[model samples]
Target: SDGQMPQTREHLLLARQVGVQHIVVFVNKVDTIDDPEMLELVEMEMRELLSTYGFDGDNVPVVMGSALCALEGREEEIGVKAIDKLLAAVDEYIPTPQRDLEKPFLMGVEDVFSISGRGTVVTGRVERGNLKKGDEVEIVGLNKTPLKTTVTGIEMFKKELDQAMAGDNCGILLRGIKRDDIKRGMVIAKTGTISAHTKFLASMYILTKEEGGRHSGFGEHYRPQLFIRTGDVTVVLTF
Candidate 1:
């Protein structure tokens, strides 16, 4: 646990922004404290801080432990036992991923490479559905029209596979598609399914330097550079 560090709060805010569903707080450095009353006070302070940030601090699992004890080769100092408890909590509380193999296949093209004599190979993490050998898929991205292609093969860790499902990071060989058309940020899915976002509306926080100066008073028609999902794009703000 970070106790009451500014960086800890900032990191938690970042996690919230990025759609984190669950959080497991491990309160470290319990070995340094000799007084039980002082340790309880620290936990109470941490809980208050968490509650101030709109979290269920009292309800959230806060496991106390000491990594220093573990590093010093001590097992009875509540070091490894705390870690074991955390692991058990994770398995008991955290929900497993619910992947629907019935949904249409979707995978974003992250990196494209040309394997010698293997045609155009695209690597990405599957988002939904299943992709099998000889499955027909479409490429959509880079502001270009869609092109239909077939999945010649699927591979994970150099092992050839007949199919891949959601959450699988694998390379796929597309038949008849050239490497020139393959680009990052492209979506590979069933034809007529992929939709590329053209506009974004988000509240931008002045995180870095808000000391003495507030956000820029750009009232209307403010044009700004937007760092969007995996790419940078500029957009005009219509007030």
Candidate 2:
């Protein structure tokens, strides 16, 4: 209960496996630690742990503060300085999205909805480049064969836009595509931009029984239901 939680490490590994390169570590309840040396020690340990996981530990910013104090609506408790520090760190360490207009269009469908007159609409943030009306897009990662469709319309913030670039949330209308053809987590890219893969590569770190919080260890060939976005799939393990 005192050291780093096992689940936290697992989550970081999962994030990296899924293409998350940068991370911000927020150390909460700093006011509870009275000794300065103890706080320093905590920081040192966190750096060591993060370094082991291929993260930039030395230059990485760690913001220590207490949310409970800030929630009290008074500056007397630990003050607002800690919160300010955290926000400053976020602005400094977090890199802005690189939106390249020349790059191919890519968007991960966050949600799919059925409209009365719109036929089908998929809402998501443009991951890169831009998505425009009448642009041919290929859907991948849901199944073997990719479905190709054209963007009929793009709407951002309730206003119809000719196109949406990376980092903008927009609902896109598809031509002749139904709500059933699209789902969350499926990536839509420009035609000839994405290729299907049979196997996924991962640098995974498995958990022990105690860390996994299971009564018994998972045996070989064990199958587990994997949850991704708004769907679940049962997968079998080998070796």
Leading candidate by TM-score:
1
Q: What is candidate 2's local distance difference test score? A: 0.79
lDDT of 1 by residue, 48-102 (tens): 7677667777876777888887677685556888888888888876678788778
Write down the TM-score for model 1: 0.71
Q: How displaced is residue 44 in candidate 1, in Å?
A: 3.0
CA error at residue 66 for candidate 2, angstroms? 1.9
Worst 10 residues of 1 by lDDT: 207-216
Off by over 4 Å in 2: 1-3, 12-21, 31-37, 76-80, 97-103, 115-119, 140-148, 157-159, 192-232, 237-239
Error of 2 at 6 (Å): 2.4
lDDT of 2 at 117: 79
RMSD value for candidate 2: 4.1
- Looking at model 2, report the run of 10 residues with the lowest lDDT sum: 198-207
In the range 1-239, model 2's lDDT, one tens digit per residue, is: 15478787877666776777788887777767888888888889999888887889998898777787788756534547778877888888889867777889888888999889778888888878988789999988767788989989999889999989988989998888878888887888999998866456445456556445456667766877776543466766665
